[model samples]
Target: MSSLSRRKFLLTAGATAVGTAILHGCTSGGNAPQTPASPSTNASPAAGGEAPEVTKAKLGFIALTDAAPLIVAKEKGLFAKYGMTEVEVLKQASWPVTRDNLELGSGGGGIDGAHILTPMPYLMSLGTITKTKKPLPMYILARLNTQGQGISVANVYKELKVALDSKPLKEAFAKAKAGGKELKVAMTFPGGTHDLWMRYWLAAGGIVPGKDVSVIPVPPPQMVANMKVGNMESFCVGEPWNAQLVNQKLGYSALITGQLWKNHPEKAFGMRKDWVDQNPKAAQALLKAVLEAQQWCDDPANKEEMVKIISDRQYLKVPPKDILGRLQGKVDFGDGRTIDDPDLAMKFWRDNASYPYKSHDLWFLTEDIRWGYLPASTDTKKIIDEVNREDLWKQAAQAIGVPVEQIPTSSSRGVETFFDGVKFDPENPKAYLDSLKIKTIKA
Candidate 1:
């Protein structure tokens, strides 16, 4: 990408706000950092007041840059300020482990909530693709962040001159296949957003994920090391692993998820539904705290501080340097491409990033079915309403004093477009599914 004036970058980058008018430096490059002007010193009083039903709660998070909101909330005391005194933020090993811990509940020495994939709560709610056969009630109170995920290709692909166009990648895979080398690609989880993103990108290039190449599931933090040890040829995951791959010279990002779909929804603030039901006030308190921390995270000024804060041994467990570049939109596409536009940056609060739009969740659910992770006959509407806790988000939003004008009046954001120019209509998901030229499921 060219070095444009901040004003031009914001204008041409085209990451417009869907709901919030007060979008920060991300959408249009020229703007002041967004931070809460003031935070309360007062704590909620107990007994029939706004105090939490349960102050102690356990939240699980994977080691990625998007986990910043949960970490920042704890580190910055936003949780305590909201009267969630004994909140414990645990570092989880993988998505499967997080699900297991949530099933265990905090009292059983497991997590009550998590920094989770947007599609997971819906999947978990229906018992469609989880290890446990039993259905579990799940709710998405807020979105953790948008974009910031990437598809990193190994150094071997350098000879093929891999770019956004996957033709070379396909041809290279064919050549490797003829030579009896089985090419492989990996993502974080099945029926998860990362899996959908990788599948979409590959299918766009005429590479059928399950047929053209081997698809593997690896934890986010393990992506870099796995590729380094020759475990996989290419992988898609959220940062700082993608950035670390570039730093380690093992591979370069062929595409960021934002490039695939600008300001796309990523991780979310999801919890077991029964926990939220049993502790409604505690759920509200959790939302308020996470939202406050999200406001702090959207500020460009805090990106560096955030890198250091999450780099601690207990959080991301990686060097701060690997994370700072992508957060600042200084992307190294590892194959000799770079960009400096702030528009491609990860978002926590900007572009209504915190709102759990039902339309967005619908798209995820539809895509999961597209890949056959869920049955083609699955009812999306029922699952979305069951898993998305938008009402609770509104209650917390009111408590936080969000301007009345900024709150979204409806759940749907209307039609969503992709970098490849395909459009998804939430109202006509079946039509959208049928329109796809390459799909694991036939219409």
Candidate 2:
């Protein structure tokens, strides 16, 4: 396939070292846990299908609200319904911590699965962004949610009257530098979703990233604190942190990511590749429960309960008010922009949101190569095959009773248009990269 050709080219181009330098740092997503309780052994994975090799598993997550499906599945006993009764949803301090914990591997001080950046599994398999040379192979079982993230600037940004207009941001950044202050913007991790969002936004505004302003990596939970302490002028992250920033009066929402790109893929339901290989039945069981939970999260009636569930001291630890507004499609920009936009809110299921499209993974791979995170000659298609678990997701979806018709006929979503009018064609990733006016590729 053409993917193989690209893979051969990447290896031929000597990009191994570039991938190594990135392993020491990176970022992704996840959420909370309830008090440990063995799931009731009611539903059985072995009833009519292949029996799972293992039933108990530990998964990791962050505080972001997009992690709702995982948290809900665990809290509501959905995992037990599929016989993954021992599943425990542990809260992670940051994305780096999540990666490190995953590297430890299941039962070895790490987790077996996670809710994470869609690109992360691909990067991990290629050894482009991990702490191990072993290259943990990860599977994208389903998407957790999409498009509830935002870029928030400190209160001073209110003067700019901005929404996708970064020129004002650039002018403010220049002014800050002229006053002897270096402007720093933070994202959850390097080479992850937030990083891409922040980079795209900054570049669109004519800011030369590292030159005009510094882009720093901060943990998800630490974003607000970092901003409060003047560590950064703005940050791109998932909610309810973004919403919390507005509630605390620390910053104003400059733009919602959904506005940046409608229905964009966000966090994913991911597990170790070996885990799937050794315990295929168990993996399907996990997907079955999580998929059900995704449907539950997408329900308008369940959103309020989901907000309250994740708002627990153990889950998101934020007030329900902070999370409830956005959960119901209420956007308070904190800059005098408020819109009841249910159309643009977060989605866990519906609209073919959970399918792990090979095209989207390719897009992220292209972005990795576009930036310095991966080598320009990186083999995207080969790594995409190694990381994306669409085949497995199909199996789980079928086993869970998702109609054959609901399964996408094609994995590619075709060429997508960005808010800036940039087009990303999965069939021609190189051209898409070349079309970009700003990039970090090295000759």
Candidate 3:
């Protein structure tokens, strides 16, 4: 497995230090106690049937509406049409819990796989989990959705007349720069995409994530409640959390991730490595079910119904309106801002958005190094190769009838540019990291 290069790692980690500090700092207050899950009631790993005769399987997800394809796959009987039977979908508690149960192979977690953030399966496979007994094999079968994340400010900030704009969406940053009162923003995790995206957006607009504004980590499900009480001035998170705020008429979207990076990868279908190795056919069949579901979801006619199914108590558990608000790319800022831009956020398609590229995986690893999660001098290329299960993703996509071009390639891709002019090249991360004007420190 390739590791992150020390030089590049230092650069990335330096840029992201503030975000990671916020993650570790904020969660230290202790979060809502997690509901313990009973051990697996299902048979052991050895109990799965031989061959792939039973087409149906159970999948687990937190009731976020973006699990739309999974919901649609079952609701439309697409899984059944593909020879899947008894396609049971279970809701999970949170990202960490979702990851743990999947790794442990227990509880409402009797899944062949699940809808996960792009970085999760990679982290689990790498044994990055602090207390996991043993690392399990993990692979992303296909990308599910992209660019549904947003930055939302609290009603108090709106009442206080804070400015949110195309540049520097954080109102607190400008206040601090001019020596005004400090404001706060919240995110889910330190090294995760939510934190990275939030930091990237703020930094691009000339706001320093750590110095210019105060950022905290609040679990995704708790974002709206936190903002309502003014625990935070603004937040950056994925749907339907942002949409939930709008539906409650409490907050509004200042920036959508798509505006940050069009057709970016956000979520994916991931399974344990051993599960994939042992049940390649089962994996392929399930991918077929989801790919078909993806096609259906992309259709405008099916979106309303798709929103309703995913919004059920078994899924996101939010109102269909909130679920559909962002899913359909129909924004409701609640402060009197609304628009319809379907392509602004994507569900599925043939673009690289659905394929997990090597560079994309490398980018996250770069972040891991930057935030001091790994040694600053690790081999970046080696780690990128190991984390990206491209071969497995390809096999699954082809089995589902997706075109080969839709699968990722190993070609070193150019770094993405924020509206502010920072560039990230998968091939030359060190130079990219060195170019940043942000504060840097040793990992």
Provide the overall lDDT of each model, using Cα atoms, as 2-decimal numbers: 0.79, 0.76, 0.62
Residue 36 shift from truth in candidate 1, angstroms: 6.1
Indicate the worst ten consecutive residues by lDDT in candidate 2.
20-29
Candidate 1 residue-wise lDDT, 1-443, digit = tens? 12223211111000000011111111212223343433453655353477888888999999999999999989988898888989999998888888778778887889999999888777677865455667778899998988999998998788776666776788778888899986778888876878889989998888888888977777787777778866677888999999999999998888888888877899999999999999998888889999888888888877888889999999998888899999988998887789997778898887677888888888887787787666676767777777788889889877887766456667876677888899877777888889998887533
Show model 1 residue runs off by greater than 4 Å. 1-48
What C-alpha lDDT does candidate 1 achieve relative to the native structure? Answer: 0.79
Alpha carbon lDDT of residue 87, candidate 2?
Answer: 90
Which candidate comes out best when scored by TM-score? 1
Clashes of each: 1, 5, 25
* lDDT over C-alpha atoms for residue 241 of model 2: 88
How would the candidate models be sorted by TM-score, starting from the highest? 1, 2, 3
Residues 129-219, model 3: lDDT tens digits: 5245344557777678767888887765554433234353445457554885556778765566777777776666667767767666666
TM-score, one value per model: 0.90, 0.89, 0.78
**Candidate no. 1 TM-score:** 0.90
lDDT rank order: 1, 2, 3
Instruction: Judging by TM-score, tell me the better candidate of 1 and 3.
Output: 1
Model 3's lDDT to the true fold? 0.62
